[model samples]
Target: MAAPDDSEDQDALYVLTAALLTPARFPAALGDDYPESCAALGLDPYPGGYGLVIGQDSDGARWTVVVDDVSLVAVAIASWDCGMEYDLSPGERTVVSVLPGWPLDLAVAAPGLPAPHDPAPEPEPSRDGSGQDGPTAGTALRLPLAPPDTGTWGPPQRRLGADEIALHWTQWRDRTEAEDAEATGTAKRSEVAKEPEVTQDSEATGTAQGADAPGESSENGSPSPGEISHPGIRRVLGELRAYLHSDTAPPLGRVRSGFAPDGARMLRADGPGWSFVARTDDMAFVLLDEEPGEVLPVGRGSELPPLLKALDAMAVRPA
Candidate 1:
């Protein structure tokens, strides 16, 4: 996995943070699927995956050091998550590519470094839209990697929204129950239990998800009286069902499962223009590019329960 040494006279990278670029887990902002995500970083979709070490070089410029040492980076991330310190200095032999800038955002900076910024530009021949201008193509003029713009509704934001829902599934679940009770004119289910009501802005997940998605209304997002069926929902469901078949399955990691509370499995799946998040034992939420900011709710009825089971059966999980 070694790369041509284009980084001449570069100082040691002061590691700030790191992330895994793998099939089962990756930064969703890059792409919906593993191959697409690797393409975004100009790397091969190696089954073993790559480790993205984000840090500032001696020059105070940000760089993403892509290394083949997946286990090392994984351990570092685990240590950080546990509030333990782990030095993540990859061996020079494991260096794959040293890319400019970061594909993901990081608030932390090295103590003594100046503000994080892009490296000095040394422009090479610009390429056509495809980026293959000549034999000199891909010869180390690494462009600064930037996070996808999420100011408006798009694929990047849609994936991030799904991430938030998964991250705060319990809050959303409680909200769904409340919404159903409100729409049905029945006493709230939690009234006897007296569970605190949750709104989208629930500190559980950072930004305000609000009661409804930005463009969504009760008429579109809840299963209270009758969950309105959309053509897009039907389309996405069909695609997901197709993925269950061996011959029709999507790429690796397109369908993935993660740990959930109470013996449930959290499922996150993405496709051409949509992302789906669900719990194996609960209902699912659908977000589509065509329908901006709307998070359509799918009830756990006759079909959905079985479908979610099938998805979990074939879905990949963290090792």
Candidate 2:
């Protein structure tokens, strides 16, 4: 694929945004785990992880420059999060592979560049769809990287819903409580003290985390979700238990732990067709491919609290 040089010339690669492709952190569009994600980009899953520097070449063709220098990209992301401008330019030596297109959707684009787009495919060596040249063969062409379709609900979309829930946990949590209150004919909001916010997103989100499901109240006086005999939730909980007892889950980052406000640990776990997000101190929201665009809440019931603690003990944490 075409790439630009380090010169501050007009033809240099124009940096737009970046992300980490590590065991604990990666775009959901790629895959649920590290090895699967690396395979999607045709790269090996190295222990140190790679940094994806998404940008446009001089022609405004989108490119994802994979680099080995994870710290450089990490620092740039941190700086940008703090509203500080830091020029993100990965050194040539750190460049691992220059992928064809952007994996995740981006709302921002570089100014003075043509709209970000995939570079036109180089004409393929003409070959019929016979035994040697078919899609499953070695000579077949590879498609450019792109984000998953938002119109459909699948594994990628499921993970994305989980991501949004984790980002807007407080909004979902409060709404869950309010919904439970309405269901039980009581005002739970006025009676309870609010804790520190888990995370927030200003972006408009109408998601599964807000879905109302049938569940009994926990001893703590909050609705306990997923304990209802919903088949999907039951299957998910079963799979989670397998991960703990039998070690039957994916090894490379199917479950991860992140920092949460007020000394809580935010957990993100993904399975074949579902995603799970919760806090050790609070409830959980599950998104499943079968349900399609709906999040099911699981409160801190007696069973769930211990399960969450076990998962947290096994989850991978950011260094």
Candidate 3:
């Protein structure tokens, strides 16, 4: 298949966390030009895990360089160990470690062909020879990391182990924004007091950290966010391909994962549509089609059974 076209778009890569972060203070903390820098590097500054690469941005001061791949931004979130409600300000430079789908180049660039024993088999006829409406096997996007530019920085390895992949950072700043309403020198100190303990169990399921995942870095200037904070979660990068393709109970695609630092409520997207949203401790919501505003509450996580039932209902059928 032909690669996605990139000639028409004007977006750049390399988004400064400041540009993308909200509740507004993030921009002040990082810098005003951060979003512009993100555009220079082909990064989409929009909120949430999904982002698109358009070009490169640099003025030489804040967030110098990087490429933007939507999935990668989500993965980067894990590396930052940005807990469910924690501040992500410390992760400004962490984007450098995100290398786009470079390792899967061979597979991605390869021509499409049917599998061996590849002769097209006739579809089994239904009751009156009509084709059955069984689920059709299809391909999902599996992007390879783009090769890093000569001077660019990136993580050392391409994948991670199980437990190591589950790490994430969280803080309840938003929940406590009201508490800091009074005279405050800087809300930083008070934020610490209000910080909620992120029990690991609240994360999306199957996000176990991989103890043996590799931990190599290309530059010493700044450590990869996950390396310093959530090494195990960082390892999940290594298992990206596996997670997408594995025959698992609750198959998933891009998901806004959240968890208590302890590993309890693992939320994940469940769907028949191409998109789904599942937050571990909150709720599983599916946006089957946005044009029509079709939304549905698949399950709830506060109580485990409802969550599991929702997940089971959403699980992909085994081949």
Candidate 4:
């Protein structure tokens, strides 16, 4: 495959889709020597042939294996966003080690390379409602997956559960509110926002908004002011935001529901992106994404770690 080209715009990063299976259960349609065949292309053998499949748009930017799934269907997805901070560079490799017992999390370990700085601050609103962070239109796009070809699998049409959709919508609402507060210079996002233990600030706000925030609609039951500001398909934006925050380092243990992971590192520098590992029956995943509308479309088969985490988290809960 072609390496990423840094000189190009970040959007140039291509999402290549590969449907791979173990040698033992190799798809007869593909081939018997699929593993060896892929190995010829510099593809490393993931313990289960599950590795990343996406890459940057720069030269020498080979795709680094970051995520894998071994049980039902083993798959890996490598990804990179060219020309940006908090994104994988041409040669730096970021891996998502999801072995059987190991913490199925994501991590980026660069020995001597300079850590990239956060992208220039974007204009936001202040806490006071008078500021600009109110309602604006942002695009809503979906990052395609590999196996279930949308074209063949039919146009992107997976229905999220009501609870799942509600949770994400609530997350986006909170994210929008936090951004609005920041934009208007009204308040700051608490450092402990990621922690499950309720923060004094969040509690205060939650109480003040009482019944108006979680599970409650805006006055007249219309879109809240925050929701109106960040327009476009609501569900897609929520999914993208959550997927980009998967954990990659140690402490990879699954997340403790009702409580945040202690010392769980902030993988993304953006104000609210955070991640933790959670598991579903027979499967485990890392939940990523802390901010809404912050994810970019990587290639097909390559999705945000947070999304995998969400799926795994969903699987683990009792049906």
Q: Find the candidate with the highest TM-score and give its number.
A: 2
Candidate 2 or 1, higher TM-score: 2
* Per-model TM against the reference: 0.79, 0.80, 0.23, 0.19
Where is the poorest 10-residue window by lDDT in model 4?
A: 97-106
Give per-candidate clash totals.
0, 2, 68, 42
Of candidate 1, the 10-residue stretch with the lowest lDDT total is 217-226
Runs off by more than 4 Å, candidate 4: 1-47, 50-179, 184-310, 314-319
Quantify all predictions' global Cα lDDT against the true fold: 0.81, 0.80, 0.30, 0.29
Q: Among these predicted structures, which one has the highest lDDT?
A: 1
| Model 3: worst 10 consecutive residues (lDDT sum) | 154-163
Model 1 agreement with the true structure over 134-196: per-residue lDDT tens digits: 666556465688988888899999999999999999888888777776865554343455645
Give the better candidate number (3 or 4) by TM-score. 3
lDDT of 4 by residue, 251-315 (tens): 11112222223522111111112222221111111212333223221111212334444433422
TM-score of 4: 0.19
Which 10 residues in a row give candidate 2 its minimum summed lDDT?
202-211
What is the C-alpha lDDT profile of model 2 across 1-319, one tens digit per residue?
A: 2244445476477888999999989887778888888888888999799999998888888888999999999999999999999999888999997777888888877886778999765433335646354453455555678887776878888888899889888998888877766865544354455433333431233222332323445643454654456778777888888999884655688899999999999999988888899999988888888788888887687688889999999988887
List candidate 2 segments past 4 Å from native.
1-11, 122-140, 186-216, 219-227, 247-249
In candidate 3, which residue ranges exceed 4 Å CA deviation?
Answer: 1-64, 67-256, 260-266, 270-274, 279-283, 299-319
Candidate 3's residue-wise lDDT over 37-61, tens digit each? 2333344544332232211222111
